[model samples]
Target: MVDSSKTHEPLLVARGITRLFGNAYALSDASIALCRHEICGLLGANGAGKSTLSRIVCGHLPASSGEILFKGAPLTAGSARDALRSGIALVAQETSLAPDMSVLENIFLPSYALPGRLSFSQLRHKARAILSELGHDHALPLDIEVRRLSTAQRQLVEIAKALALNADLVIFDEPTASLSPLEVDRLFDIMGRLKSSGKALAFVSHRLEEVFAITDRVTILREGKTVAEGVPTAGLTQADVIRHMVGRDIGNVYRKAVSPAVTNEQAVALEVTGLHAPPIVRDVSFTVRKGEILGLGGLVGAGRSESAEAIFGLRHRSGGRVLVGGKEIAPNSPIAAIRAGLGMVAEDRRTQNIVPDMTVGENLFLAQMGKHRGFGRGHSARRKQAHELISRLGLPTDRMDANLLHFSGGMQQKVVIARWLLIEPEVLILDEPTKGVDIGTRQTIYELLREVAERGIAVVVISSDFEELLGLCERIVVVSDGYTIADLPTSRLSEESLTLLAAPRSSAERNAAFLRDLVAGHGGTAFWGLIDEDRFVCLAVAESARSAPMGLAAGHVYLAHETAIPLALGRRQPGHVTESDGRSTVLTPLSNRRGHDLGWIGLSLPAGSKLPNAETLSARVAGLFDTPQDEKIDA
Candidate 1:
């Protein structure tokens, strides 16, 4: 992974890059620098030319006028071949996949351009290893056509393609858009590995939190110009980055309702009971109250989209009870679901939601076209509703007849959500609503969803972004292996805690088994949780000694002073600490081999129970990290 050029200078530098498409400028004076062993974040709003700059650097497009130095040598403009040969690889935002090509073939597509003896067997093995490392051991089928894959699956292929190159300088452009928190962690680990191996990385993303988390320095773009160049990311705040990207201050768009129209106790607008769809979905159940934004949170391919499809009637469900306003509705067809007051913006927009040949207005009222299939067409009323919605949503009234594909991905998603709102359904479900959208548009959509709930419409949002779920929703239902395992309020959750809650059942089970073994060896309750400051978030707990019966449960957050074992929680040292009430405890910190904080594992015993050695407990806890994640206790 080391670059042969052992210079102390930056590995790659693009100075005053400018590109023009006809009379308009796509980029102007945009500059960025990527250094070896460091990740430089390339940031901008939706149309801010970050992608344009990345393409130019990777030789996907010819720079109208600019200078790029790779390993202190000038890079040939607009020559993808030359760039690849020079060890520059880009995982593009808009994928470059051949529809008919298999996943294996598509991953190594860059290789076919070079002269070499083909070894399909070696490439296949490498591809499998890459996918496995990406946490998709059996999810993506190598033989399947790229066209048949989901958006998230296709994104994995994009990542694999770049990794296959083993390039010296890698550019990750919106690489985590479709990946969940769990999967993103895996990808970040790989990035860390590359950085450690002395390779350079340029990470292009709109996610500010991610930018701060993974980047060492940042380059900000505004209106195709570099506003901030090579600034230490740690020294810059989120506000500073936003101002640079948008040329103005942007407040938090994830604003909660000051006075909500409805509460979780008010009324259930959408309820799915014992939902069962073969294969992907086993059993999923949740209830969304009027005016509540409920999040469906989980890892990618953990049956979240499948659960949504099953509930919306897009996928056939073998068993499930759908209820709207206390009345049972059948999961027969999408039209039936719509008629029963359900609206859904599916995950796949191009295939499942949009019609490329139709005008934006036509597609906006597409649902209306179906609901009134046999009845008299109410053209006048439909037009009135469309106009009002357009004004409210700030839609393009001037270009109503324009093709839907003419809009950017962000605008297109906004239009899709608007269409569902036009029908005024009681329940509206959006799957990965912010997927592939930039930061500014993401904020707008968050506001839109908040507004939707304010109007007394129940909102169910499925997303891979853990922070989005915590910010936008009041409650989150965690799905793993197609089952709704934990239902908890957002107040008690953090991105770290939610990740733990959404872990796959097998991993969770292993952790739980480890806890059980600890309880069997000792005479007390064993629990796993994150202990930060005064807040203690429990992820899993197993009790074998009912005499102790610590009222602690999973998916709950407790303050240090409020718990029965307050002394033990407060101490949180490497040894056992006994409380005033004589309840003894042993605590140990746990983390994976990668040095990720997995939180603390503790054992609590009744007043007179013999305490085990602290070192012994630590050794047992270490085993949890060595194996798969332990079970998430049912909330």
Candidate 2:
């Protein structure tokens, strides 16, 4: 037992939590504490014992040998009743609600087993009241069955159920994984309210941004043990957290794809015209240029994957025309797509991409059996291919013959990518290519994608990452509400711009098309582009401490780096740019002799900016002088 004499005794505590199955260790000596009114983030790649630890904590699974304590009192593991009675509630990735039961019943299901007779009328009143308190008035019907609710509504029902349990410690497992931004904001509001009410919460999510936004402290687990714990969110970056989790630095997630030179004889790789998939994908038309990396950007359920499936013939299309190299191709069948020189890396890799029980070698070559003389006899060749892929993808070579299920989620995702590569298709569709992969493995996958694109393969990538689109794609097609709203050049894409595009718009806003065009036009500007907080630097430099937009049009508030003085300045601030080579240059707001405040002019006289440049940026900045002194500023 911990020294309870400490004033901040944890509401819930785990000590030496260990769970193992046969020879495979799942959770080993894992322990963490949750304090009242605190939100702790539990982070790790998939299969890093996050779920296992959560299960042990919530009493869903027995700790092989360990103890769970509630308010410093000894508690039993693997007892659902004990956990509920002890005020520990868990909302898993899969919402737990009776499909046929009303939302009211779902929220009060835990307390229904009490000694008193069930009262449906009273329960409905309480459920409605709770929903109202959670800011869901009339949004979710109390009497409506859970099966009819949207994914976000169902998630709220789960949260409401947890809240109704009066749980001291509530665990949310990827609650926003599939939610829209508005839904996510609503959920966060609910969480914030819960925190204010002195309740403890644990949020487990794959999104680093959400973790930073919602969590107070973070605990990162790796390979079954807590590698880092109680790490504060302050002064720490996403790359820092990912480095601790994956044991490597991966701040540089973006990579420029070198365009392959197209010969006049080269054929058009992929063509789709008026493709219509009812209810999910609407009339969409686009062409995948030969050897080009085309990116599809959208929110979840925006039909990015559905379009990919239609292209790959996995899902039925109501109406569409597809052409491979100018030759008309039939649809509604995956085999036809494969035959037409196309391959797909699916979104849900666990179920859709890989055969878990199969060995890595078998999974890699599963789609291409014709290349082998026989199935069993092809092991040697398959092994060679698997070894090559494993090496190329930085996978563990010794685990080539091992069951794919035994590999980590990151490694499994890599295997999924490798499986598709064996087909050597002319056009490849990768949906959420790095879904659950860690930073290091994600880089390897990006490199692999580049290699494939270099080989004259028309790559169509569907990603939820706006930054990724800006990085890997020459152009991005934004999808929303089953419609292709805009096709934007990679030159005009940013995280903020993509967010605005992915979000749903009002009918009037939709018809205007001004926001979309504005985003597409000005998204590529380098605002807030200088700061790289991943590295340790005690110093920051600014020249005159005045601001005007550098690459943007609007002005913003400014602050002195040393004194932290507040000042209202334009978007582009006056600053002395300094490089690591000790060369100091200055940027002064240039106006004509009339002092009309023409855009700022930078001189390579002495220094660089306060932000450090890790790359060989001196030469790049040296050419900035050649740029026109006055560029038309956007309003």
What is candidate 1's local distance difference test score? 0.82
Across residues 1-635, which tens digit of lDDT does each residue of candidate 2 receive? 11212125578878788888788998887877788878888888767888788878888888898877888788864587678887888987657679899888889988866677977887778787777655464457787898766454677788789877878889988776545454465578788888889898999887788899998878888878887776676656998788777877766666555465544466679888888887678877777877778898776556777788787777788898999878777878777777778888887665578887888877877767633444464556556766787788877787768888877677788877887787678888888776555556667888888888778888998876666677888778777667776676655455544554564323213212322332233231122112112211111122222332122221111222321211212223455444444543333342322233223333222222343231323333333334332111100
Per-residue lDDT value at 297 in model 1: 94
lDDT for position 467 in model 2: 61
Off by over 4 Å in 1: 1-25, 28-37, 59-83, 98-102, 138-149, 196-198, 374-380, 384-388, 391-394, 532-536, 545-553, 556-566, 578-582, 625-635
Candidate 2 Cα RMSD (Å):
13.1
Residue 374, model 1, lDDT: 64
Instruction: Return the lDDT, model 2, position 274.
Output: 82
Q: CA lDDT, every prediction?
A: 0.82, 0.66
TM-score of 2: 0.70
